[model samples]
Target: MKNNRGLLIVLSGPSGVGKDTILNSLLEKSQNIKLSVSATTRSPRAGEVDGDDYFFLTEKEFKTLVNDGGMLEYAEYNGNYYGTPKKAVEESRALGQDVILEIEVNGAMQIKEKSEDALFIFIMPPSRQELMRRLVDRKTEDEATINARLEVAEYEMSRAGEYDYVVVNEKLDKAVEDIQSIIDAAKCSAKRAKKFIDEVLNNA
Candidate 1:
């Protein structure tokens, strides 16, 4: 039999790098991969349901979880606490579901510190100019906000070298295929496949 444990993928990138779009496409084209849902301390917006939109928790409750090691990663964003819950991710992986945590650089680093087996991947923009074009094209934020995001993007990209793999989002479909290929190749790596191979050899 093949290895039964699922891959834990930590995906991180700059704010304007089309991570959401790439993830949407990747999920559609992949199987046995589950996107992780994070918990948040902020009040839910209209039509946003707990557990679906996010696991809404009080600040005290969130800190309690962090202290108990129930959080894989956590950070304060705009005064609201957001964190990836550890238990659900572990459960999904146990059932052979590859779980992807689409978090920021700081959170990704936290996961890395906690789990060395996690596969870390960073999504990159083709270039700085292209990245700026994307942020402007969206027209969803003011000029000041976009500039602030670009500054953060620069800092985030500096950390790309820390990741195990990097995918450049020049074309959506191609990026998805490349990420899928990375996952497929990782599954066959000697480190991951040796146990199953040994079992087969022993049986034979």
Candidate 2:
């Protein structure tokens, strides 16, 4: 139903991982899901729009939100602060739109602690060697940064077991289908669809 509550989906992976790629591709296929854009203190690059890409703010503004408890979860990366805005996410969910967040490992942990009902997903490549190749192929990072990302990926991969679901991006189409199946299964869970069940039983 249109009035049904939404599901909060937390998606996380390493820096060079395909979280964004998979999410964006999923968005193209699914019309009902809303992508959660984070707020950041870092300046946007050329062609990046505010609210569309990220909610760009100053360091002081970001710190203000942090101190005021406006952020759901936040962390500093490379001297820039990034966080999810709690209010926007809640409002979107209340409107029955599935909110999918692309977050870091630490932020995902925070979400798990706060939103226990949230569905957490961990995305991974087929292997570390393949992951490195994908990162190199991006041509967006230097050798030093690439190595550092690989190191972080190893540690992040260790935390994959903590998530509710693990979808390896061995092949994009198959992974997307797997993710869709997970969402469908979650929607049909007894805990979430109790109202429909009650109505059906009453009618019978």
Candidate 3:
């Protein structure tokens, strides 16, 4: 009874977690879902496409969009603005495509405040040590940056209680399976099935 509208899924996790990897696998496995690309005011790096990588915007354009309530959620960092475009999300959902918003905890919380129909999912690392190990193994950042990420991760994990589901990312395959199952169950929820139920009763 999903009807003609798709579910809005908000996925949030701390930095250094394998959220991008997990999401890539999930997208490869499913055709009915699509990632919600974010809009940003930052300049694109090498080989980055304008619309594909991000909807690149000037600062004035970004501010105008935000002022007009065109953004689902937004944040400013390092003098650049990043946000989810509400129109694109609504258009996708209207086409019965499940749109997954991979954002930070604060953005997820903003979605919660604005949209009650969204399902919030948090990705949890196996443990602090394992998370740190993964971050260290990347070797892309200095020790200080890695330590800062760990601290931020702790804060993000503290807010996991607010999410509807928390998938521990110990095993990639298992975590993806769990999320698939969760989405399947959410689709069949009483609220989602109400339309079908009404039609059946009316026919009877």
Model 2 quality (TM-score): 0.87
Which pairs clash in model 2?
none
| 1-204 per-residue lDDT for model 2 (tens digits) | 322778899898887667777898889998889998899999899999999989999999989988888888999889999999888899989988899988878899988888867998999899999999999999999999999999999999999999999999989888888998998888878878777878888889
Provide C-alpha RMSD values for all models, in order.
1.4, 2.5, 1.3
> What lDDT does the true structure give each of the candidates?
0.92, 0.88, 0.92
Which stretches of candidate 3 lie above 4 Å from their native place? none
Worst 10 residues of 2 by lDDT: 1-10
lDDT of 3 by residue, 1-204 (tens): 337688899998988779999999989999988999899999999999987889999999999999999999999999899999999999999999999999999999988988978999999999999999999999899999999999999999999999999999999999999999999899888888789899988889
How far is 195's C-alpha from truth in model 1 (Å)? Answer: 2.7
lDDT of 3 at 6: 85
On residues 117-190, what C-alpha lDDT tens digit does candidate 1 reach at each position?
89999999999999999999999999999999999999999999999999999998898999999988888888
Candidates by TM-score, descending order? 3, 1, 2
